[model samples]
Target: MTSLRFTSRTTSDGVVERDFTVGEVPGVLWSPAAGPDHAPVVLMGHGGGLHKKTPAQRARAVDTVTRWGFHVVAIDAPGHGERPLSAEDEQVRDEFKQAMKTGDIERFRKVSVGYALSLAERAVPEWQRTLDAVQELPEIGTEAPIGYGGGISLGTAIGIPLVAADSRISAAIFGGGFFAYEEELAAARHITVPVLFLLPWDDQYVDRQDGLELFDAFASKEKTLHANPGDHRTIRWHGVDDGFLARHLG
Candidate 1:
């Protein structure tokens, strides 16, 4: 792993928050000052149009670190957060929006799937590099059990491939996302870790059947689907309880 440079600050509650640069990727790490050396760790990814410092992402990280005494790490996804979008990516985004506006599900799916797959190709490797850098930090113990969590389309798109390829992650929370493409489904089949999948039955962007199908694709012997009534944005606030994360990752 390459050398990492980080700046840290401690909150009143003794939780340490660090901002780091691993090569070109920007990330955040949260750890309890007095937590055990071998405490569990969680790797999280933010939703589309969000960054590592997003309120929802930070809240989850703080909860895990302060309440559960776990180490939490999150990184910005490509073309989001600090990463600027390329002209090609911007064009694709515009195309996706137009497709959605026209209610052209086929075109929407095509553009979305293509863009997601491309991002995943870069994202998975970047996450692995971040993990390598994080493990070298003194606050995060070596060989700690790692859990992965994320929400929305970009999160799912990268996470499915990431969890499938990386054996270090023992469990995962996949929510507010769906698999409408062959590559994503193929990637899902490789994830055998315990997974808690959340689906909003009335999600505007994701079909309920598509979400269920994505969950079904997981080869995990221990997988649970929690579906609630609401749209994508609201359902996450309702379905993802503190206890759910505690049970799976704490």
Candidate 2:
């Protein structure tokens, strides 16, 4: 087992928590030590089954972004982070249950992803308040816009909506954005930010046509796709590099 460690500090109104739980989600708020006034900000999300651990996995990504003068708020999604199990929080739990009952994995996915989207939407009001209060950046009202957002596979739940709702988000990076809501929500069509998508061409789990269609339908002219030649889980190993980030993010 990995021994977890965190160091806490305070802001003005509420206690600033490191390895904190704004609600049920596990999160860490990292701020620029020197320039609280002039830093950019990012709201990052984690993938399915992996919570904020993947952010920890991407240590270079986290360290580099913070050094580049952006405050980072990395959050665990509904089920993954510091949340409690409740019958009331049955949407995701139930979706998992229903899928287990029927063994219809695809239906299970839609329900699961949909449930996370609902929770993410519900959580945004409080999250926005956190952004204003904890980070204490230059323009709380107009902090040069949120620069980048992303997650591995399942974190697209939050990433998709954030891109859809806010024009302020400038760039989005997603890996294994597998599910495409063709009927309910057009995932790719709505994103306004320059999107960088990383996926494997041989992914056995994702619907290949749907994935291609979404990539094809990307509404932003700045959108681009990278394909790795492996099953779904190999992108992190074979797909991207630091040079890729430098070219895209800078």
Pick the TM-score winner: 1
Please give the CA lDDT of all the candidate structures.
0.81, 0.58
1-250 in candidate 1: lDDT tens per residue? 6756786565657788888888888888888878667678888888877888888788878877888888888989988888889888899899989998999978888888888888889999999988887778765656677888877678888888999999888898887555457888898899999888877788776677888889899999988888788887766455355665567655
lDDT of 2 by residue, 111-206 (tens): 766766666665555455445444443333464446445665665656666666666667777656466665314755777667777766777566
Among all windows of 10 consecutive residues in model 2, the one with the lowest summed lDDT is: 9-18
- After aligning candidate 2 to the native by TM-score, how far in Å is the CA of 70 from where it should be? 2.9
TM for every model, in the order presented, reads: 0.93, 0.73
Off by over 4 Å in 1: 8-10, 236-250
Candidate 2, residue 93: how far the Cα is off, in Å: 3.4
User: Which predicted model would earn the best lDDT?
Assistant: 1
TM-score (C-alpha, index-matched) for candidate 2 = 0.73
Candidate 2 residues lying further than 4 Å off, grouped into runs, are 1-17, 20-26, 53-61, 88-91, 94-103, 123-127, 138-141, 183-187, 237-250
